[model samples]
Target chain A: MPKLDFDTINLGHGSGGKLTNQLLDSGVFSVLKNDLLDQRHDGAILELSGKTAFTTDSFVISPVFFPGGDIGELAVNGTVNDLAMCGAIPRYLSLAFILEEGLPMTEFWDILVSIRNACAAAGVSVVTGDTKVVERGKGDKVFVNTTGVGTVHPKAEIDIRRIMPGDKIIVSGQLAAHGMAIMSVREGLEFESQIVSDTQPLNHLVKDLLDEFGNNIKLLRDPTRGGVGTALNEMARDRDLGVHLEQRALPIDPQVAGACELLGLDPLYVANEGLFLAVVSGAAAGAMVGAMQRTDTGRHARIIGEFTDQHPKKVVMTSGIGGQRIVNMLIGEQLPRIC
Target chain B: MPKLDFDTINLGHGSGGKLTNQLLDSGVFSVLKNDLLDQRHDGAILELSGKTAFTTDSFVISPVFFPGGDIGELAVNGTVNDLAMCGAIPRYLSLAFILEEGLPMTEFWDILVSIRNACAAAGVSVVTGDTKVVERGKGDKVFVNTTGVGTVHPKAEIDIRRIMPGDKIIVSGQLAAHGMAIMSVREGLEFESQIVSDTQPLNHLVKDLLDEFGNNIKLLRDPTRGGVGTALNEMARDRDLGVHLEQRALPIDPQVAGACELLGLDPLYVANEGLFLAVVSGAAAGAMVGAMQRTDTGRHARIIGEFTDQHPKKVVMTSGIGGQRIVNMLIGEQLPRIC
Candidate 1:
């Protein structure tokens, strides 16, 4: 780490003065240095072509540092995944921070390093950013906002309008890990095993899927904030169609399930950071799942449901106990700041 | 008001659940609806070609509302002006919010309307965004992050590398108005006259200047958080050149000057929301200032300083009484949350 006179950030660090410059030069710029960022202009100049995808997300998860990942990693991965769900090649990101005064310099440095590593892992660059500090008690440790821009995959025509009645709904990997991890930490809960947040970048995996499945991939949604159940309900309502699911096919880590059970929470509604829900054509469902299972990001890929004409604007699941039940969208706040 | 049952925003509205959908459907979406936003996809798809400008900023100004403008208006214009400084015609924006729970719904609605009006006024669209609600006391009322994308102007070539020894420094309008406005409200220091923020969009004025001046314009920067002094100091230090300013030429409103005197603050270190500093070729400086003064955004335009060969990498100013003083970048915080 670059040497600094202060151990914690102060209001002057965001004052757009000498202290702000010192903080950026010795801290953020040193960690995430790039040609575009080196320009040091009001904005980054980029070359973008064809259909570009633009998205923004603000992450305010409590406890800046979580079990498996920190807020910095989550900020980068969250925006990257949002772009990936659009069938885009995530390229550039703009990171902005709302830092609370008195935050330790070490913590700030760690977050910057995490951001750098996350960007390198996702194959994207943080081209521009802004930092603002609020007085103590006015903010938490840190709040991050990441906005991503990417070029849409040429072969991909992923859209909700393309969903057919028989399209299969698939889930990539296990669910409820991210939400449970945060809850466990917040509530001081303990279990037989540890629960870690599954916060990882899904851009590369998404690129591979789009390259192979092409137009057969009808839609992709990351089950973040609200989990698989909420995403499926949104699809059903938006398409004015029904989603039929097999409960036995739903994937969940044993630890996450147990924690959910202990907390009286449903895994279906819990958030998933690194997981995604995909809607693909029936003819390619088996082959797609097979391909996805071969990759690290989708080892537990499962064809859990299919769109149907019955029960329009609703999601119905066939349980392992042989009873059918309707899965409505999440009603109230099950968990806050659970991203 | 779209018949919301609640009087204030709660954590559930940001949980990505039923209440979240209700909030979006009745509030944010209804106010900021457009073709791209109406799609309601993970991201907005736009056909952008050639050079693009991307930038992000988080607005955490206290009080939420100020004398001349609110945080919503400032957030939109701030990002737009950043793009303007890059010689880009801002086209699309991604808006994200970190809201504190218990904020009244009426206040939220008013902010939303202000955002809509500002977007319309600036000719930009809010395409994709995310909202997260932090518990009361975890955050202030609201913090907005706006990431903007714009296409670069063809004739514009904005680069500091083109700065010459005789380059003229131009201030688009009066300085310290925005800083004093926020200070007036925050400190509750009453003056005989009101000090209103000069928060306005400078994109059109910049476009016109670029269209006419082309490569003659060397660099452009908005004097936002650090005022004109800090911005000039940054340029001088980066280019390893000297900046000479005439204190008499600096424009400031009478009330603003008096407020700065009372607060023991230097106008040079104050912040400006709707002003910019332009570096132009000495030969075209007079013509450019004349042309700028004809426009609404630059009616108070003045040639305050110029790059000089003396005092390399430092800013020196001449007083009206014929004495020179070294104007340094702000050292520590004078005012926080002025933006």
Candidate 2:
């Protein structure tokens, strides 16, 4: 194949089809050959002598700093939570920043401090980093990408494939707090109560649940950009199973619910930062819920739904008025930069 | 010390001073609690069980695709060269992208194809990756971060710390090609000869040199962001040595030199994507230069300078007119996003 010219980038580059494959073939894969990248999986799977888990996330939030959290905190916790959701003990992280020229150094300092505090609170360490500044106006204020490496217990076998019919789904805390916080701040929405983003790292909370419930936990996910609805839909699709959610059983703060209602948004589609949905065996669901309730971060834990065999690849939500509606994948972009 | 707040960032963060220290202490270091990061050195000192080298780079170049290369190729080659600089055999890479929403899918796909091709040429692999989208206007078209791992031969012990007073500086190929290409396109500078970027992976060239010189190579740097002059200045400062360069000995493509002169830019400060600066003991410099010349990428390699014990942390240049002047560190930001 001919090598890609460096003249310009066309939209076909990102299509995930022939052109995408060509770009990868002509430009990237040609330079750094390796086995793991050849697999082309969603993530890399490694065999390790010691217990370890690795994950990464990138923060491109607009305005750099926003209500509740900024890129710094988001970058840190995002990776930490990815490890936590996997039943891994979060440990260290690699932080890399792409800064735009003319970005105020003071602002970068503020974000760095936030990152330090977040790490301290989460009990993880920042081990490595790379920083680069792009031309002015060519980049946003800053973009943060973080990669985390953690240790997982040897016996843990958590996987989405373990989810079965009748398994109960429990949410860790209030939904839509994060998305509402960002929306309210960005749009200057006035409300009786200010909605703070629930962007806390949940490694400890995850540890607590795993310590009590052991292997009963089938799967875990942090409903972020696409929100809880999208996360559930993905789970259903991945397992070839149906999920039935009860609107009345879902937990939502009044401030977040009111904000979503006012904006004509569904709480189900609003992103959550410090919340997670877990699938546990039917017999262990009650015990898991009880364990979750004992932790402050999981005080709002509730049995929102259950996995089912009917209507695989679909999420059906029983509305407050007793009508069932299919919760399909997100049709379009909703709240932006809620991460 | 007071904790750093996330509400806003300030300029002092990158100053390498009190605020910078606080930012690391309160934000970054607090979250990533690792021994390597705690050291706060120019680069982390990692110990591997086997012969291995690890390096990472983030490409935020504007115009996603530029005159000679794009983010995809740059990410692959940048990391590959970093590992090679450490005398490691280039192998694998992890590619992660932070994409702006509404970026044409076509462009994204093209970049992937470029990545695939670049890896094939470099004999590396894209073992793992992550994809994220931010709201329109929140991010640039795309940002790519690549982390690479390679294995070093057991006998190699390349280190900048080994640089001595009687060391010779050799530059591979022409200087300022990459930077000139970017500037010309960005500024619409018309020239009789259109200068294309010199972006290419150099691990193979590096292999040629290492195979010939063995452990005689003292230091290697790609001369990226701040350019050849900046990279040399950094080495001088880091090694507590003095550098003297002969202007007449430097190899400059006439077109690139003309572009620099026309724009009132210094060719020495312009970035080069496919060139590297190596400092070797005077005794081994001749053999090393011969090895470099054997490779197509290093055909124009030239001996440009030498290191000395006097005038530590200073770089002096013998001008073409026989006048001597100090080459100081870059005082302020030069052309942004030239990478």
Off by over 4 Å in 2: A1-53, A100-102, A134-137, A208-215, A320-322, B1-56, B86-92, B98-102, B127-140, B149-158, B207-215, B319-323
lDDT by residue (A1-339, candidate 2, tens digit) is: 134453223323322222333344453332223343321211222222354455556677766777788888888888888788767877666667776655654576578778877988898766445666655555677788877656674445577889999999999999989888888888899898788889999989888777778788888788876678878887887799999999999999887888899999888877777889889999999988888898899999999999999999899999999999999755445755455
The TM-score obtained for chain B by all candidates, in the order given, is 0.98, 0.84
Q: Candidates' DockQ values?
A: 0.91, 0.08
State the iRMSD of every prediction, in order shown.
0.6, 14.8
lDDT of candidate 2 over B47-146, digit per residue (tens):
2235445455677777788877788888888888877877777766666777665565456656767887788788886654555555556567788888
Error of 2 at B268 (Å): 1.3
Q: Of the native A-B interface contacts, what share survives in model 1?
A: 0.90
- Model 1 segments beyond 4 Å from truth? none
